[model samples]
Target: MGLAGALATPAHGDTKAPAVVNDARLEAAYVIMGDGFATVRIVTGAAGCPALTIDAKAQPMIVRAPHASLPLRPTASTIANSKPSVFPITVCEASLPPGAKRASVDGRPLPMPRPVIRRIVVIGDTGCRLKASENAYQACNDPEAYPFAIVAAHAAAWHPDLVIHVGDYLYRENPCAPGHAGCAGSPWGYGWDSWKADFFTPGAALLAAAPWTVTRGNHESCERAGQGWWRLLDPRAMQPRHDCNDAADDVTGNYSAPYRVSLGQGAQVVVMDLSHAGKKNIAADDPRYDEFVSTHDALARYARNATFTFATDHYPILGVTIPDGEPDKPPKAGNKAFQSTFGQVDKGLVPAGVDVLLAGHVHLWEHVDYSGNTPSQFIAGFSGTQEDAVPLPSRLPVDTSPLPGVTIRQFDAWTDGFGYMTMERTGARSWKVTVRHADGSLLRRCRIRGNHTYCEPIFG
Candidate 1:
């Protein structure tokens, strides 16, 4: 299907509730929001999707679909090869009633979305860094140095009703050097072992805490961890994901249509596959520039019907980042691709109705409130991965511009350490967001009202 045709699938709004399921050997099973249905996905060593009993009757799980693993390059080195190793993993999925209250995998009770969601945990960039290209290797074995597991546990303990992971789930793209104590013995490949170590294991608690809404990150781009991402966490059907393993077609592989996940009462969350947008400014004549315009237009259309809307795209439409080695350099706006495409789509970038823009590519927690008009932007990329660069100034220069023609009225930026944010619904149109460090200590508290968000430190 063409990119537009592929995007026609709706996101969510099924009336059937979720129900209990039973299966042993299931590595992970949870309800996920996807195009037009609430899906039950499971990873197991077993060969096929397990059967789940729904409302006292057994129903077949996802029909067997071809696995998305690519044809391996057998000629490659036996160890530390550039190619990803195939694991004996069977990932299967099937749609389920959205209202089911109880679920279990391998007799372990799994989580389900609350009938009415009141609290949500948002996180992103959660993987141990073991990259050879950048010469960055984090101590995957050190809890203090790489605290995603601890952070996920603390996040689960908060008892969030729903969880949204912004992206960058797998980052161990290269093997650890023999003498490097930091990433010693870490599974450093694009295979399941790396994915399990970097994400699934560390984030197990939160994964089981509630239904998740996942956004695709650049790390999961076609050339990076894209293979593992499609096989494991993509919320879409298996078609485009299978295509993601190759550059056979145009950009449609990693990119996807925006879909709506209803928050009930007319409020919804629109998920955008912004994984393909690179840091470089795309020229007006670039083919991808037009594709991105369509992407942005589709997003605006999806949010038009919702009474309230929260948008999730891994690439920050507006964010602050510094040059790799020049931490002292002035902070600059990120995502020039979006700036070019969205600038042409709508002068506002996102349509005016989008209440909050949630993203996580920057590797820190930040919130920017605009003086004029625009959705308040929240960057929650500091969940687990090595926090990026040095800390941003407590106050950016008065003339700081995160996106074209957008003035920052006030903002709160934090990169002191690894952290996550929790959003608790305070009213129909308002939510209270709390930012916390890896230890789960409160850093900032903010209130949401329409497109405005104002934050203050928990303590002076």
Candidate 2:
């Protein structure tokens, strides 16, 4: 069956809920508000429906909880580069019942809000690519090979309080050849159908489990899937950009804004966008460079307020694993950007109380501890996407290792199977981070105290 046909077919024993106009069901499940109060977003494919009205009252697309009737609000704007502009999404804020284990959306049950947030699951770069010419190891058609479905299921089973996806949600840009395993008759363009197959469907379970803080990766560029990125995942207000064509230097519509997620008291996660800043020496006059600097300074100020602060972005600041076919040279521009902003050990540009720097892009996993730096850097991009060959242990060595006072204390890299990181807050000042494979096999575990990290092998 084709992608849309397959989705239209209901799962076994799933009583078909009353269909809105054009059979719109909930797509891209997410919680907007994090605390005890929650605002849920449900995207529907019903064309021209902009908001959902519950009962006879015309609600502004926001639904309050405790069994409220919701009706389709038929108003939505067309996305740039999208066909027909048929996807209209709505957001509803509801007060989940106390001690409620599950909540209902349009009569469909879903996991409820957590009383407290202690565990957070981090995954990234999970889009599946079907082109055989790309030389990916997994067979795209086989669910077992392209196991993001399984990965998302495992993550949902853990019942995390929150999910932090460091970006790259859509990937099926190239069409699959005839008779390819999972690609035969599949939708191949950058549209709602492709997104449903690549992300929404496989990610449904996890998306319903808890709220998510999403980052914008390079794959989410306007030229590639920017329209979908803005419509589906971005938490910020939408601002349409007409210049979303496929151009290498085009950075329009790339949201460079920085936002923060409060993780209870004394902790917060700050998300920044460095998608537009390419791996070249960004001139001081460049707006992207200026934005990066201002964002970095804002992160520094946030660090001072929170006892434990985590900064996440799509690009890695240090020790990036070179992609398979890319050149072996160091990332001069990325390094320069970091040095000019956060890597200034002598000038104290790196902020205090920032415990961790989480990033993804290189498709490998690494944990780097600096001798004098406040935050330990972690690369957890090995969620489900094809991984690049693991670089040598000492690959991409820092040019000026002992930069004034900063020194590389220790570094570990892994380029094997797909995996994710789970952070469990054990105490007010203590937390445990575990790196596990897609199937829940423990790979490594570490303890974080103040700003120091000590990790040991799980079975060594």
Candidate 3:
């Protein structure tokens, strides 16, 4: 809150509260995109909540939302699935107006949203893969194998005005096989340790560099890392059934209402909670299908009013993915569930007013342009997770489509392994995007004009 946050009377003699928690361990402090404002979030090891300054005066932060700024007890679901956490975590947040000028927690500085968002880093599906389902284990200690820290450092060095993690922050779900050196000793399960290792530890630099707009991926679904998603990044007020505490309440836990984040300069992003969406199509009769319809309707309303709108969901509605286990393997396609639901809702999948679509989950970088009044889709799913060993065809068929009406006008992809993407706003209606590898090596450069994205070739 360098200064978008205005002053609020300190809650209950907050001036007496210590602005610097000299005794508590400030594990993390960063700004994340709030519902309409910016929220200053901190994870501390102390039982006592720390204090922050809105301008020159200190204000005490309450517990987590809808109640106090306090931590929730781990439900039975977590008790049975995760190990006892070594760190005592208290997740707390305080909102600062979009115009707050100065803000600090425990005397440490925190970055604030810029008056004009000019540089943005888009990342997705970032984590070390440690899944027993597929018997896949990434070398967590190897930089080349799991380069999220490097990618984040590079993004921070670029001086981004804002950061958007498309989704899927947790992946160290299952343990490393006994004596397997690749992922030996790495934390697993949905506890604080797992989340710390998976995201917070690796993404420290970028977290401090700019405020983040967090998106939830399938990995963060109620069935997976949803518990941590709610505690740390879901960008919504804490609610009961949404905590992923019981299987009985999964219908509520999985589907969250969509909201918009207005970035200055006539640009806004509609964030959707389609983490429940995956490879299988959700039939129209299913109760969850209505959630997609609601999201589509909300996006239409948002797009109709904004000059430039971006639909940021974890899954790409009209993207090109390298499908795993398919015969030839180069059978590239888009998200099936979204295609089915959005196809029926709108002919182009994306509503008429949205200009850009940002997502991750395919574990690669892709840019797909369409033939009609369709939005361009950019996938930055190459952040860290190991990708399909089966590679995509060097050239994708352009006459084809992900759905019935959205014809592919152009296609581009790269990042054999880990990487990230950046968008630099250049004009009122235009921006330039760069695709970079884990080491920040430039792979492609593109320009965006409304819904169209044109990128220079990785080789040419």
CA lDDT of each candidate?
0.75, 0.62, 0.78
Shift of residue 296 alpha carbon in model 3, Å = 0.3
Positional deviation of 330 in candidate 1, in angstroms?
1.8
Query: In model 1, where is the ten-residue run with the lowest total lDDT?
Result: 5-14
Candidate 3 ranges beyond 4 A from true positions: 1-21, 65-87, 327-332
Q: Quote the RMSD, in angstroms, for model 2.
A: 9.2
Alpha-carbon deviation at 48 in model 2, angstroms: 7.2
Per-residue lDDT tens digits of candidate 1, residues 132-176?
A: 756778899999999999999999999998898898998787778
Q: State the lDDT at 226 in candidate 2.
A: 68
Q: For candidate 3, what is the lDDT?
A: 0.78
TM-scores of all models? 0.89, 0.78, 0.90
Return the TM-score for candidate 2, rounded to 2 decimals: 0.78
Best by TM-score: 3
Better of 2 and 3 by TM-score: 3
